[model samples]
Target chain A: AQSVTQLDSHVSVSEGTPVLLRCNYSSSYSPSLFWYVQHPNKGLQLLLKYTSAATLVKGINGFEAEFKKSETSFHLTKPSAHMSDAAEYFCVVMLTGTASKLTFGTGTRLQVTL
Target chain B: EAGVAQSPRYKIIEKRQSVAFWCNPISGHATLYWYQQILGQGPKLLIQFQNNGVVDDSQLPKDRFSAERLKGVDSTLKIQPAKLEDSAVYLCASSLSPEADTQYFGPGTRLTVL
Candidate 1:
């Protein structure tokens, strides 16, 4: 079974500081990884996705994630945190040939403050 | 392009009652999916449809939960005899095809079972 484990249940960062959300994966084979963000009372938005093409994936809102195969990790990062960046982040995995069935990790809530 | 659309942004009902949520996928999207997101948890796939045909529903609780995309465009998810555990946000998403990696999401329908 393909699954992702979010290392932190909550992360707090001051405005303009760097932010990191850790995630580890357990998959039998190479898998598609994704980062999604959800604000309160809003729908989930795809932050980024990592297929086999590239290890470093850039996403909207100045966010990016690096897929480290050897480490079995895909961690989301941002150079500067903003108040708008406060939201719940999820790490998701999609196994090949599954017709887009996604397995999501328990989310990590981000809190950005001045 | 318009994103996925869902009706009745919020619903409240008593346990053992029934409720339904509706979704309209993006224009020309051939794949639709329903996901249940409990508070503090990432969304879980409940079902997937490929052009009006059920592609995957392994995780759905068929005894109490049902869903259908009758015309391959709009979809509906029904929960009969709702349980308190069933209270969660129901999210609808769609992609251009079953193999598409990016899925657009709609503002979810929040259901509360008393």
Candidate 2:
């Protein structure tokens, strides 16, 4: 079984400040991880993914995440938060088999304050 | 390339009413998935399809939900006798293949069961 846990249900940050959203996972297989952002009334957009290539993965909109195996974590980070960055972010784990299935975390709602 | 598309962006119905949602994935994609996202929560996979065949429906509420993919292209999900708890956004995502890590999502159909 594979599952993801978002440590923070909500995170508030001032514009231009650093942003961090913590996530952890449990999986039996090697596991493929992903970060997705959802703007209100919009579909989910893939931010980045870790497929065993790099420990630190860079995504669009200046977002990035580091996969830490020892910590069982994949925390998303942005150098600076922008008003446009305010959205709900989800951590997902992909389970491999005959078909791949994704398990999502509860999500972290990032609020960028002016 | 066009992204995934879904019909009936929003729907409201009383308890026990039946509702269905349609999804058209990206062209040439062979894997499709259905997910349910409750307000303030993450998306949960309801079913997955490889081509027109079902790969997984382990998390689907079989008693109330059913889904089908025709010609390995468009797909439909139906809910019979929906409950108030069924109020959520139904997301449809597709990947190039089962092994692909990235899944492009549609805007989703929000269903509210009063």
Candidate 3:
């Protein structure tokens, strides 16, 4: 079984400031981690994933995440935030090999301000 | 590549009514998924299919919800006697395979149960 926890339900970041969203997971075996962003009335878009190949993963729209095995964490970050970045972000986890099922965290609503 | 496609962007129904949502996965994508996302919450897996075979439906409300992937290319999710609590956005996603741990999603159908 696998599960994910998003540390925050809401995160506010100023435009041009750094953005960070924390996530943790519990899995018996190695797990695949992902970050997805959803704007209002939009579909969920894949941001990045960590699947044992690389500890640091970069994605589109200036987003990135690093996997920490020791801490069981996959936190998303952005060097600078833009207004377009304001959206709901989700942390999802899949089983090690099969990736048959995905467990989603109770997403964090990101608010970017000027 | 074209992303997943879904029909009826929005629907309104009253309690004890029925509703259905359709999905067409990306071409040649063998794996498809259905998720329910309530406002302010994350998307929850409802069902999954791999080439016309059901992979999982543990979280689906079997008493009132039924889904099918008739041809292994397109799928449908139906909810009967929908309750007020059933109001949510139904999202469809597809992937090449579970091993990839990457999924592309559709715009999703919003259902409001009055």
Q: Which structure among the candidates has the greatest lDDT?
A: 2
TM-score for the first chain of model 2? 0.98
Residue by residue across B1-114, what tens digits does model 2's lDDT show? 999999999999999999999999999999999999999889999999999999889999999999999899999999999999999999999999998878999999999999
Candidate 1 docking DockQ: 0.77
Error of 1 at A27 (Å): 0.9
User: Interface RMSD values for the candidates, listed in order?
Assistant: 1.2, 1.0, 1.5
Off by over 4 Å in 1: none
Score each candidate by Cα lDDT: 0.94, 0.95, 0.92
Model 2 scores a TM of 0.97
In the range A1-114, model 1's lDDT, one tens digit per residue, is: 889999999999999999999999999988999999999888889999999988999999999999999999999999999999999999999885759778899999999999
Candidate 2: which stretches are off by over 4 Å?
A: none
- For residues B1-114, write the lDDT of model 1, one tens digit per residue: 788999989999999999999999999999999999998888999999999999999999999999998888999999998999999999999999988988899999999999
User: Which digits, one per residue and each the tens of the lDDT, describe model 3 over residues B1-114?
Assistant: 788999999999999999999999999999999999998888899998888998888999999999999998999999998999999999999999866578899999999999
In what order do the candidates fall by lDDT, top score first? 2, 1, 3
Task: Please give, for residues A50-111, the per-residue lDDT of candidate 2 as tens digits.
Answer: 99999999999999999999999999999999999999999999986668888899999999
Model 3 clash number: 0
Give the local distance difference test score of model 3. 0.92
